[model samples]
Target chain A: MSSGKIVELRQVLAERFPREIPPPASLLTTGIECLDRSLEGGMRRGTITQLVAPYPSCGSASLLHDLIDSMHTSASQFVALIDGKNSFEPLGNTDLLLWIRCENANQAVRATDLIIRDGNIILSILDLKQNEVQELRKVPLTAWYRLQRVAADSGTTLLLITSHYISGSCFAAVQINNPLRINDLAELSYTVSQTRLLDFIYRKNYAELGYAQA
Target chain B: MPKPSLFAVIYTPYYRLQCAQQKRLRTESNQQADLPFADRQTELSDQYSQSYSSNSNSITHQTIPPVTVYIREDIASALLEDSQIIEINPTAEAAGVKIGITPSLAVARAPELQLYAPEVELERQQQQALLQLCYRYSPFIESTGPGVCTLDLRGRRNKNQEIWARDLLSRWRSLGFAANVGIGPNAELAAQAAKFANPYLEVVENSQLLRSLPLESLQPSAYLLEILHNWGIRTLGALIQLPREDIGQRLGLEGLSLWDRAAGRSAKVLHHLQPPEIFKETIDLEQRLETLEPLLFILRRSLEHLVLRVESVYRLVAEIKLQLHLDSGDKLERSLPIPAPTQDITILFRVLSQYLETVQTAAPVVGFTLEVFASDPAKHQFDLFYSRLKDPNRFFQTLARLAALVGNNRAGIPERLASYKPDNIRLRLPAFDWKSNSSISAESDQPRIGPALRRYRPPIPATVELADGKPICIHSNLIKGHIDKQRGPWRTSGNWWDPDGWEIQEWDIQVTDRGIYRLTFSAGNWAISGVYD
Candidate 1:
């Protein structure tokens, strides 16, 4: 048969005898409605989910602290946060949180690689949002792809936080654009966390996102 | 019905000499791995054949004079003036080198004689290895001597004793020791059989082999043996032929014991020994090591052997202690604790290698000793709602790597200090023991206060345009914007009585279209402290 006809015949056979699909992996919830809803309930295991904060006072740090608090209190799981610019402030109960305060983007990426590959942590947050864009640009694209492969192999949830879209290796991306005002300082953190809105920006497979396996 | 107790004795003749040879052979084998394939096989074949023949009792004819070798305690070389030979290889025996003969006489008799000194540490290590291997056969084992041990086979019911005996022999041989195993009704007979066995032997009650054995096999004192020689008692059968009461009356208590041992009727009281849980390996480098690769290579090999030993004892390595002896008469020691006890070599090696990477040696290392503390594997029951670390050892190793990448005090479980100083936080290593006591409260009654602040490490310097004691516009390299609204000058200070005293006037302000930033005025200088996100 011709190649086109052979493809048609295989499609017909596939429709008649469909392959069994495995169940999707369990999701790790951050307990934030807006972010979780943007992630379709929560971040899926063995995938990279990027959170982009385009401007200062965009509530990325607030979101990160809320996520860490939610992991510690609600799920009782360990979270490793690789702080990109060493900018994270202490807040809430951090008994189950492993915070690695790195000086630059390179150190943060390396720390992220080490934590993700350890396979002991359930969720790893790479917070590079506060880093200078010039330094963040120096982080090779291959590092993200390598991290994606490691996360996939280790069956971990890797949340990459950045100032803008930097790599196509992530499985999904969401933009946190809530601008904070001086008045918001008087409000409760949980209320602010609940009021935050996330815009779902990107979702695709590794190959579709230009991360081809070698 | 209670079965008769059978004793098995494992003995190695010239144990100190053999330990030295084994150490040499091991060093040679390690060097051989780098040799060409053709040269490696030929060298190994020649050396191993010589080693096997030296341990063998069978004699072979030689047309030419063989290389005769002997062991002495104080010899620096074969030409040492007055050192006496304590142990001699079979070839040395054929060449007329007698025990207790001086090295000068030994060389005079055998022109190509070689002398070696005993390695006390290596001998001790091999003896411990032998005991550890024997413990696998029976829990009730005794350390009879430096190179001998006896296992009590009371409850074991395998009729085919040769299988396990051969198995034990092969296992001992794998560690470079040539050993013999003998099983008998009593410990005395078993020890006698072990000295005579080609590789293995078994003797029963009143067995002809036991009767024909010479009196020297009983290890009587020289004085007693001389008396027995005068009496013309040449063999155990002859000694046992005399009436026991008559010998006891004539020769006293020592005579009675000797006769009992001869007749295969000695007491079987074994001082049972519980093998020590010491897992250590040390190596003295042939040349001083000045680089990390070779040191790491040795460490990796040592860790493998230690892991094997720990696994054999049904335990895990809880901690590793490394001591590096330097050429400058100094020792650098480090102890790395395995958060979760494990038999995994990779994790253990990582712990060691990571430590070595940061070690700053003052001199080239001459040797290193690695010792592991063994522990029972930890067991824990996690709560249904709680998730525990999947691999604690690997996670700790990763934590170490993260610490290397970041600062040491910058990575771990973060806890806020009790003091009111802003950003007063410290990182502590996570607890290794995973006891699920519900120490962490699952739910908290405290409310989340507000959005978290991202603090600038050093507080970015800024020029503030102040009007009426309130900051208006902020002009910094990072952020330059006019202030639309301002909060207050919150004054906070502490530690005024000490050298590290601090005071600050902090204000929260909103710069138009830029962000909400915190400004601190301290010591007549204004800075952007952090951003409230």
Candidate 2:
């Protein structure tokens, strides 16, 4: 209907075409290969995972750094890092650090106090190494429940990177350990060799396997 | 021993050119304007073999010419709702078309340049705001123009400035802007370097690339630029090979700047946003009510908002414009002087209301707009002295109410001749003169005003029916009589020509029991001035 220009345009277009598919989207990869495999294609935006780091320098900061670098829009973002010991250093760029706030520290309250706070995403890192976490006999059970509700209500992923603690009040206690296996090899030398084991497990799910670590 | 050469410490300031100035720059002609250039060069050559200075042997000049984003008319629709695209079309030439043409062509086709002009300005503003974030990285960032900004990622920034630059590019892109940054020894190169869609980073060390770039990238006007392109002399290298004389013969004076630009040199520097001379916002209400409550309330909120906005930028208010629009659509703009910024809403409220009352409210007020102009060069230092009585904000609130009742004009400081000689030179007027730069110098360092001086307006003749010098009044105006033990003709005179410029010098006369009394002679009449310690 649009005339000869259409016919000329059609004749001009009967050639090659660029691919319609877009370049592959880049995802922030967790260096732990086994964990990455469990995550399928790695942590997508909606996926939430618990970060239970038992020690410092155990790649907790490394993971966050990679995530922030990959996202690259944290400057305008509202990031909440509840550093119990005030150790969550927002690295990368000073320009990026301008928008993050570290609240819920040196507090005067129950965990319920933190539950009411506002933020786009909340990262509450409790220092299991601190005396406060170790001696929490006075903390009310309601406080712990409120903390969980805070993360759930806000839809914020709460990464609890902490040291290992021996809590006596155990009800079917279970531990998920890093896959590294350290075995005694005195015959060889003082230096030891180990294989890193990476897998997920739930004792309750494995009734037959019982308490075997995956 | 050989002396080592030190890199030049360049200090460039961005001068905020007024809108009129920018317009003037756009219209300035180049070829005809080159008469001065030819004459200057001729004179220089006569004095010294000009080639010595003109030698292009070592091209030290860097071009950081600013690139304003230009969207072709067709590209407009594509960017209409895109916030990432800062719309700054100065000319609506391409009002019909909407998006997708090359960046260079978008610039070429734009006639009115509304899209490019305004976009660049807006981009510059956003960039400056970005600079607020960038300030954490380095204070060396200088704004050359809208979108045409320069930063000296010098010192420690040398290590991460590239990464920072890359990150910034991504940030801008995410924000929906096609931002390109070029960094060189100066701003000119950085700007020209920003034209590419990809990360365009250039250093003076990368000067070799400048030669290969087109003369269109230099300072050529769009028309002449198109001609050069059609001629196939696309690159700077192609243009430079032409005898310098021929290029000059054709392009004229712009040829000189072009030569400098081609050498990657920019004479244009960053322009700083000096605190605005006047920042104002006026609101027109739906209807007019005579009561001072709402007017005062509005004034309070507006003052708070203005203070908050300017405080982050600069401090103090030099002048205030209170424009009241009557229901009949008549606007009365009352400009007033503010000695300094008064955070106290009450003070402003009172002042504005009083000014409002001065308005013969022939019709109900439909709306009012308040604008404050301020500039504090940091010269006026304050000395430790007596504190101001009412908080500025509180004072405004009070004044706002008074203005609403009496009129804003009447609510201001009444003229009292403080000087013995009331000449234009020595007339002691209100600290805040509505027509002057009322900002106080150096915050404060003055002998405190006496308690008597707190509230003093000149005088009305009082009948001295000599009693114990206490006080007395008859109602025509407040009248008080006291024994005149100390006497002196405190003569105040001003305005040799104008009838309004009168100087009434007052004497601090003390009676044996009345303590200190202020007596002034105005219109050849003596009135009780004020009390003093």
Candidate 3:
């Protein structure tokens, strides 16, 4: 976030031409491209999911690209990429959403400011090495319940990409999505738009008719 | 004539688009003759990607072909900013003006005859030679960038580390590069330690230790230093006392980590290398060199010594340095980034002698030294059975050719050094891996902070194009670029409580070849976003 004013993609576009503001769709993905296809075409939003990897090679960034692309193409959504380690170097075509690169858990907390200021989807590129998650893990129940408790919290789907690194007790609540290889990101994007068996079956039965909401 | 470099060379481009085809951004690189694939050690390494799988190959096949007909304006050297960059691209870097002087002083150096001006070719020959040099030190070499490198010594410990250090020091000194060695548990601290030495070396455990060194040594944001000053924490040691929670809560993560770095709490590591390895050496000259004859003669022997030292070892040296002090004590160091990495003293003398005669003299030469550094080692981490493959010196030959093309930086290995500042944090890719490999970590298991824009020169550039006889951002002196349509001027205000606060108004406009350029005014300065194709 080079500028002091961090604006969302839609805001930047709509400020020039105001239009109806639609709710964002949260597309979660298993960091693995193959695994993401097995899911409902993409990772479902509004739910917490955990990713596990012993090594850095796991498709963490690739999955992030998927999740971000999902939030972007499915609907014009803004995203927050909290890079706790100061690692995520913005690629060329990533401005479709509002991406925030923060350094630690502290800046992550300020995430509230970004959401309130520019409404959009949010994800964490956290450096799990920070001890905060370990502390957060002790009482994930209280923390998450409180997070859920915040009555007026906006509808941004917060996707955290911490593997063995993410330590909050809340992690025990969700199913894990593990991706391998840094290159896997491209692999996951290709499958996001493709029709999957789950999509066909769900659409025939329980799947939402339109897009999933944040 | 200088004996030709006995090294292999290879060059390649990053992602390139083809005008002829509609899809697929393919890699544009060239390969060289086979070099040895041996290493002193191997990690939890995998060669799963050396040879492309049919899947990727087929993927590339679906891509477009390069078309000279539609080169990008930047690639075609049509843009004004790019025109300035064109001159910086030396055919070959004069052994990379080994010593970095003030920008003004660098400009002052005479445009002497080029010993080797290898044009910047599509292929990378310098990388091959650099890898050879790094291989001599360790299997795990991480490139800091062209002309600079780091070797992680923690994992690859040897019997005589100091002796090894001194030998390499003399080697680099002989080549003309100011070699500085920083030893520490993490890569950042070691890197910071290496900065003090202009041909200097030191070791520090943490930022607290390093902060005591000098403020300029640690490249953090200016705001960070200001915050430290207000807090009465002047030195790195003084700053370390402020609680972690206090820093994290106040300074933001990069700021907090910078404070931590000052306290010497770093854990970042080197990344796995691409192909070649990097090598280095600084002068361990006898307190002084006597006459010009003995001085040049001894420098040649040291150069030859370095050449033979790595003969059986697994690496090559494509660069050479001549850091000498005149009787007047005004030092002049000269280097050339040629493709040929050699040990032949006579050849070294002939190549260097031609350029030496051309340098303006202030006094008699007192100290003369030379050093050789690299691109990447020819040996990459493979699942091969051999533990260490020795270099056949072919990589040095390739470096000679490549160094002759792109300036010196292009001739060595590249490594990205992490920085709090966007520009400072840009990758400082060097040529030594073994020195850098020790710092690499297994998992990047970091917490998701958020999406950060890695804009080296922020307020990403946008050419406000012609529209209705106007360009975007055309009017305001602060807001540069062409003026297009002036959208709404939306403003956001927050963080009023903090000294470092913001009140910004933004406008979206369609810039030149660039897409929607985001023009912003925060803190009374205009910045444009949306750099384009």
Which candidate number would show the highest DockQ if scored against the true structure? 1
lDDT of 2 at B488: 51
Assess candidate 3 and give its TM-score to the true structure. 0.26
DockQ of every predicted complex: 0.48, 0.01, 0.02
* Ten contiguous residues with the weakest lDDT in model 1 chain A: A205-214
Candidate 3 lDDT, tens digit per residue, B444-513?
Answer: 2232322222221345333344355333444432245554345547777665788855677666554332
- Any runs in candidate 3 off by more than 4 Å, and if so which? A1-214, B1-131, B155-160, B198-209, B277-533
Question: What lDDT is reached at residue B278 by model 2?
Answer: 38
When 1 and 3 are scored with TM-score, the better candidate is: 1
Q: How accurate is candidate 3 locally (lDDT)?
A: 0.40
Over 4 Å off, model 2: A1-214, B1-183, B194-202, B205-214, B219-233, B236-260, B265-313, B324-329, B336-370, B375-390, B399-533
Name the weakest run of 10 consecutive residues (lDDT summed) in model 1 chain B: B61-70
Q: Regarding lDDT, does 1 or 2 come out ahead?
A: 1
DockQ of 2: 0.01
Model 1: CA > 4 A from native: A1-23, A205-214, B1-5, B28-82, B89-98, B101-115, B129-141, B152-175, B221-233, B245-254, B268-276, B281-286, B293-305, B433-444
lDDT of 1: 0.79
The residue-by-residue lDDT of candidate 2 on B344-394, one tens digit each, is: 334444556666555666777766677776556224333243222222333
TM-score of chain B of 2: 0.36
iRMS (Å) per candidate: 2.4, 32.7, 19.1
> Is 2 or 3 the stronger prediction by DockQ?
3
